[model samples]
Target: MSATAPTETQDLAPVRTESLAELLIATERPPRPSALSACLTFGWRAMLKIKHVPEQLFDVTAFPIMMVLMYTYLFGGALAGSPQEYIQYLLPGILVMSVVMITMYTGVSVNTDIEKGVFDRFRTLPIWRPSTMVGYLLGDALRYAIASVVILTVGLIMGFRPDGGLLGVVGGIAVLLVFSFAFSWIWTMFGLLLRTEKSVMGVSMMVIFPLTFLSDIFVKPETMPGWLQAFVNNNPITHVSSAVRALMDGTSPTTELMWTLGWVVLLVGVFGPVTMRLYNRK
Candidate 1:
């Protein structure tokens, strides 16, 4: 008789389920990272993206420089009687404007990550819920700092002197960074809600342009019509710009600073939770 084909049980070796379970459970799981640690880790990851793509710095560096040059030359004489004199007022405001404008990119970046499915992986990680969002703001804070330094350097070279000296400059920049960090949360919310990066950017520009241009960044609200002045004076950007300008000018910035800080608190308070909600749902 022909040899019987090997039985089905003989054809396949048995799987060692016990050994497989042992292999899987052999090592103890490490403790999860703390919230602060997780946030900083993700923040470092954001910085690494910049490191790999150095061109990302163009907005922080080149854009600020261009704003300094263009405004100082273009509006200096007409607005303040001379380029040098104009920069005395323009530099601080321009710094605020430039930094605030770039804040929108945080949203763009978040949207890009979402589109690339990076956020799906991020959500799976055992980290603090808000760490990723905070990380993006922290990374953008560095970008704000870079833009501040760049603008200040260009301003100084162009004869813009700060009466408040080094301390004042540092203080002003610190305030701007704080506000910018808070402001970025709004965009982060948009990033989660918007379907595309371009939509996020477009909406950001629409909001930012009116705010920057309408505020005291380029001119005194006093020069505008009463209706316009009312809006400008109440504008959050006006408060921030005035605070920064005062700090740089060695003048008391108490009222303006208080307003700026209040707005910062409001922005963070409102947008922070909304962004988290969207983030969790998305």
Candidate 2:
């Protein structure tokens, strides 16, 4: 008679359930997917999206073509020595610009996800939280890398080969990529802050345009007024420009890249935590 009652109580004990806060507080770092494997997987997925929706490729592909034509043919001769010379100078700027500009996608896509409740679904997954942004950033960088390759290929065809040899060219590109990746945290904050994709675009434009133009992207900073020149000279983007130019020219500068790397370190230092905080609040 007691066996039936004993079966009910003795058979099982209630499992403890963790509160969300408890789970989060006790959470360990998610196991890392191999960086190389993750990169390839994420990169291919992103590129596949571009392949399926040809329109999405516009930012990387179409933008460069228009930028090259608009800057080179339209303003190159007036701005630089000649169209050809401008192409040589402008191509590097354009390459850097293209990658830097693509960082806007971070916020825009994040904003889109927030607006569409995509992130609501994302939170339910067991993966590393930062992996979402990490994947997006790396994938987008891959997109930018592909775009840079395309731009350089076209530039080579259009007589814009780098004076720098293979190693120098690779180093220059590497710096550009690192700079892009570091600056992405700023836009990631923007993306997490805003809820709409369009707002992301608007805010990004406001910040990016002034920074890009204020740098020596098209014109040398020396040509600016003394007051503006001082600011422009000190701008991190200018350091990047100087470094890229030096790299392309094969002139090993004593401290040019140090400055560029310093900017990257500074940006990561400031924006990285800010982005993480903003994301947490979201």
Candidate 3:
């Protein structure tokens, strides 16, 4: 058999190929979400978390009631002479403390996500990162609102009345929500700095406890020693508490309101940039 010379295989034309990056850019990507959409998306996400883990709402739910009851009764007698009388002063101040206590949850939540690498995934997403953050913080609006309503309702049952009427209560809540929202950015920075969620919780409590108790939240700053009064007078939480008290009482809040708002602006301007920077570096 004549060994037929092996016919050289004809060279086939090179197949067209798309780089992975190009393929992803062309086909796999969806439109990036708008700022409002991103915010609403994360806001719903946070709400859903509460739904799934209903215990997550304890801070807004049973805790506030318990705190209102405990503080109003415990300190009311010693501080204001009667629980009924105490509720007037106590309500607004307790509202401030309740929200501040709950504000740490934002840091804890963000820290949990960071530990789970959820934030890493977020970085790769097309959504506005800041919107996600703002939305997450905004979601806390409902929590703050819930705590406000519950506290006020219980206060009513317990004989707490506001001379400022319904409008004043609403305005007080508005002020608290704005200040708390701005304050959450401070925790956001802590979330970025701390390694563990628990650490964030502990550190937040450490800062929050002294700040809330030592301020005018439960008692008059004048009752404190002159030395302590100096710090209490300057404490930003004191300004917020005074503002809330004045707002609820429908008094002129110019001085305290100015200071409270100044704190809000300062916290947001300073910690906001620092949180973003640390997040990006990570």
Error of 1 at 158 (Å): 0.2
Cα-based lDDT for every prediction: 0.94, 0.77, 0.89
Candidate 1: RMSD to truth: 4.3
Rank list by lDDT: 1, 3, 2
| Tens-digit per-residue lDDT, 1-282, candidate 1 | 799887665466777999889888957899999999999988998999999999999999999999999989999999999998899999999999999999999999999999999999999999999999999989888889999999999999999899999999999999999999999999999999999999999999999999999999988888899999989999999999999999999999999999999999999999999999999999
Candidate No. with top TM-score: 1
The Cα error of candidate 2 at residue 9, in Å, is 35
Each candidate structure's TM-score, on Cα atoms with residue i matched to residue i, is 0.93, 0.81, 0.89
Task: Give lDDT: candidate 1, residue 47.
Answer: 94
Q: Write the per-residue lDDT of candidate 3 for residues 11-120, one digit (tens) a residue.
A: 87765556555765775557778999998989999888888888877888798899999999998999889999998998899999999889998988888899898999
Query: Backbone clashes per model, in order?
Result: 0, 1, 0
lDDT of 1 at 110: 97
Over 4 Å off, model 3:
1-31
User: Once model 2 is optimally superposed onto the true structure by TM-score, how far is the C-alpha of residue 116 displaced, in angstroms?
Assistant: 2.2
Give RMSD to native, each candidate.
4.3, 8.1, 6.3
* Residue pairs with clashing backbones, model 1: none
Task: Write down the lDDT that model 3 would get.
Answer: 0.89
lDDT of 2 by residue, 26-113 (tens): 5587675665555466456655766787787778888887777778888877887688888877877777777788788867766776
